[model samples]
Target: MYDRLHHFYQHALALDNTPAPDKLTLHFPNDRPRKLVLDKSKLSQAEIALLNTLFHTNVAVHHQVTQENEWLYEWLINGHSPPKHKLERLTPPPLRCIHFSIKGELNEIDAFIEAIKNVFPSVTNLLWKSRTEGVLLQHLPEDTVEEELSVESIIDTLATDFLIQTSFFIGSPIDSSHLLYERFKWETTLYDAVKMTFRKKSFFYEQEIVTYYLLHHIPESTLKLVSTMLDSVMNDRELIHSIKTYLECNMNTSLAAKKMYVHRNTLQYRVDKFIEKTAIDIKQFANAAAVYLLILRLEAK
Candidate 1:
């Protein structure tokens, strides 16, 4: 008798069955030794088939007992409730969203989240409301340096330490309750933009897409000026590739040097020569933005 009850309990757990909180004792007809319960009917169809086949006797499953507190019963009758995280409940001001997508083992996903929390302790919320993809983090900026640290350093660490393929789409900071959804839309736009355009980057910002946006919208006369600005290096594929790579790497000599498989000094010399010929200081964001658009313009031409 004890073994039978134990098996039933195990089956219930395995099926994720939710029985009524207020359980009632069962009394079978014809004075049978084994008792049948109404709650067993809540078991899924597969479990019911198994029970009927295993017991070799028809269990009385037609009985439905009415309870006064139907609301609580309804709640329990649904599948087990999922544990909620802190992010599921909070909405705060001045939040920056970082949308992360992972492509590795499940443990890696948890490790990645922990790593982000450790690196950016200002993360106010870590959410997984959607079933489709990765976690969305709500980062509260403390200062300018901390805000910058959240994006670049996180990307570097995720790449250098974890070796897991990932992409982080960052949205601008927002303070108003009404503007929170705007931030989410921006994050999604950046995510799709990164996937489509900047496949090699570990993370990307919505602001970076402005260069491409300009390429599509700028007038032809303006594009000609852009082309004229970059024409000196346009025909030189090696120099062009080097300069583009340097700009893409945020003008970091060491990183660009490593990427180009050239020494730091050598990469610097190439960058200086490219700047001297083009008359554009690629180190400055404005000049880089121009050169970036010019590159796209030339490509389109």
Candidate 2:
């Protein structure tokens, strides 16, 4: 919808000179440098009134589209996909989306986005829905989703330079633009699930927590059992960190200790204490799965 209009407007602007007609340009309120060019002379009275309502009286134009689920407003502005109507009909190239939420001032958010664009020059689209939240959709070769794109170094620089907390949720690559809308929704779900638990972290890949994908829907009885299992270390931040690191390191005490900058003996003691208190040997597959889901549940609470 907007693309066709944009091209047409550009053509009209090229052919005409000044004092030709009233031109209305609607600038999107985001980091992306894009806007809609409306030739007022080409619009009917009704159309003009509608634009007024959309841009002025009723709501903020950028936010309006985000609130409407069916509208692919962000993608359209960032040139990730065409208008919603046409995008649904055409098959687009494989693209991946990384949804991000940055907590900071407007300037900090802008700096972070600029840094991202500088790092990933091939980034297909970087769309900001608001002052501090947006999605970055990029084109990548098929089956290379896991290999490409490391946001750790970029995030570390941004965190240190800008003094902000930033997090990202990377969704799987999809072949069609039509699937992006649903994929974006899934990214949002994953982001919300990890936000509280991983506040100090940089990013979370959807594949990393596949087992806890439905953590929010787990039955209360099961959740309670998990809560009970880890009740002793419920409020112990250090102990909880030890367990999380140990599990993430695949039950390797030496590696986990190295990552935590602690001695192996200290790490083993913490792991043993956790087992003694919970009586749930995290070394076991089933017990590990339960504890993993329990961690998500606890953080969500």
Candidate 3:
């Protein structure tokens, strides 16, 4: 079944200049058709026969496809009704279909319907139209104008549906290529979402915006810790200037003291006070690494 569906999609994509169909309309020739259509009323008996012939199993069948002359409707209706004359009028009578595989499960049907719904909200609409459109009728007259579905419209709708679903599941706005790349990793998916988002508004060089939002997801406690460290040494502007100079000089305290026009001993005194207030020993490179990174982030913003 998966292979069959894949082939159908591949064929659809292969169409070049040919106009795309409005809906998935399969035409079964008078020769060999791969599907069976069942009457809603005689479904039970048809299901039993199908199971016996195909699987030699006596399992109950809960699903069947109703054959309209031109289209097949997978039925979810209940017990049989009498065969109406209208059903016979269909060029090709509907055949009842049944499967008795032990692996057959309701979840498969649910998944299929869910996927189909995403691509075509008009599935039920088509079914409703089938009731009035009649089976095996001639194609609409070329001069008879009607609204037609286009490949572009269908593709756009599917793309929008995917973005909505992805955003809802990811719980974020998903506005950047980097975030999208990390999450979905599909180039096409990322391209479509980014294009759609850009269409609604202009996106400037977004590196700064991406960094800001990335930081927003960081833990509050971690941000608070960084904030507290910066605040502790904020009052001593001279000491702060000395420390910044020292870092700028690649941690050469003598060079920093010379640049600040201060004695080395006085610079050392301020460094000690900074350590005491922040409880961060700058002499140990590992402890100073996080502070340096935070400073870079702050400066970037």
Best by TM-score: 2
lDDT for each residue of candidate 3 in 1-301, tens digit (9 for 90 to 100): 4345335445332222111111222323432633222222323455435433653121112132334411223211221222446333432311111111111123344343354345432222112111111111112223445353343454344345443211111112233322321232222222223323333222211222343334434565776667677787766767766776766566778998899899988888887887888888876777665555455344333
Candidate 1 C-alpha lDDT tens digits along 41-98: 4466576456546552221221221233222122232222323342233456667766
lDDT of each: 0.56, 0.64, 0.38
Cα lDDT over the full model 2? 0.64
Best by lDDT: 2
Q: Candidate 2, residues 64-92: lDDT per residue as tens digits?
A: 23344324553433223456475654335
Query: Between 1 and 2, whose TM-score is larger?
Result: 2
For every candidate in turn, the CA RMSD to the true structure comes to 16.7, 12.3, 23.4
Give the Cα-based TM-score of candidate 1 against the true structure: 0.47
- TM accuracy, model 2: 0.62
Better of 2 and 3 by lDDT: 2
Alpha carbon deviation, residue 162, candidate 3 (Å): 48
